[model samples]
Target: MNELFDSVADGLVDKSYAIIDNFLTTDEVAQILTLPHFNQHEQLFKKAGIGKNADLQINEAIRGDYILWLDKNTAPPAAMVYLNRLNELIQHLNRSLFLSMKDYEVHMTVYPVGTYYKRHLDQFKKDDHRKLSVICYLNTNWKEEEGGQLRIYTDHDSFDVLPVAGRLVCFRSDVLEHEVLPATRQRLSLTGWILDQQIM
Candidate 1:
């Protein structure tokens, strides 16, 4: 309905690369989080302070669990906006790739400040459920030199994206192996995937 949201959707449909810049503004993000229809689901913000050891041990090919600190008391409006934009992006990508998004699962996740996930692929072993992955940056006043870039490894090339404000990175969930490096500052972002088919 707004210019920022419209722009992000259009941009994602146009680009199928690892990084997309200026995807969503902070102001636009706040709107989606506060909307009653979007906010009423009531299961989003729950969090647990689990240590990083278990997360790191997660196998790369095996489908991982929803491991994140979902700030139960906080409304990360930016995250919601990005996730909304991402769902649209997946649908567009599906159209291009001749896949239907409704046949799978989609989820929204967040990493705040020091939250870092080890290198992994979103697809599952013997499942092949995940097809596309998306990450949306929400930190404002972020520095490109702060070192919170996503490290994506491909057979032919490598890609890194600064956890800068209003950026969304999308790639094939199975092809791109990526990790969230440690940051010099607080890095906030939305991370998730669109599975190829529903396993549950």
Candidate 2:
């Protein structure tokens, strides 16, 4: 586990991003999928908005996903397990990369068919506390034809990542410009940011 953390640290140092497959075990992913919010998503989840605070707005043309924020204290056992691992990774990153990440905020996201997020950066213009973006995919048996690929752009290159189950993608929140392509089927993932300020 320490070695895995080290690999993530190394990737940040080299490329400012990392894509790690099987970050969670099959059982772990299954447990997380059992979250009650997923079952009652229509009632519990809210439309994800762009911007923050006073500037926040729900523009379906830009993005069309529903999200439910997670609370560690109230999270089920499976979520706690995942959060504990994230805490460990946070500690390791602080020690190795000096990111100074004080806390993390995460939400379960569900993108209904034909919904997608337009190209954008994760960090806010006024507030830059969000240092890192992390996404853990939970869509099992996903296929290339499904079309829900994450497209990350760089200065001279661009690539797409399929939302495969148990795959973890981490990147600098302020640096990367990315977007989610519309999928023929629904897509599911746990998406969040590691922040420099404490919110937990």
Candidate achieving the largest TM-score: 2
Quote the positional error of residue 88 for candidate 1 in Å.
2.5
Scored against the true structure, residue 37 in model 1 reaches a CA lDDT of 27
Residue 171 CA displacement from its true place in model 1, Å: 0.6
Off by over 4 Å in 1: 1-16, 30-80, 103-115, 198-200
* Pairs in steric clash, model 2: none
lDDT of 1 by residue, 88-140 (tens): 66566565556676533333444444556677676655556666676666667
Best by lDDT: 2
The C-alpha stretches of model 2 lying farther than 4 A from their native spots are none
The stretch of ten residues in a row with the least summed lDDT in candidate 1 is 63-72
For every candidate, C-alpha RMSD to the true structure in Å: 7.1, 1.0
The TM-score, computed over Cα atoms with residue i paired to residue i, of candidate 1 is: 0.63
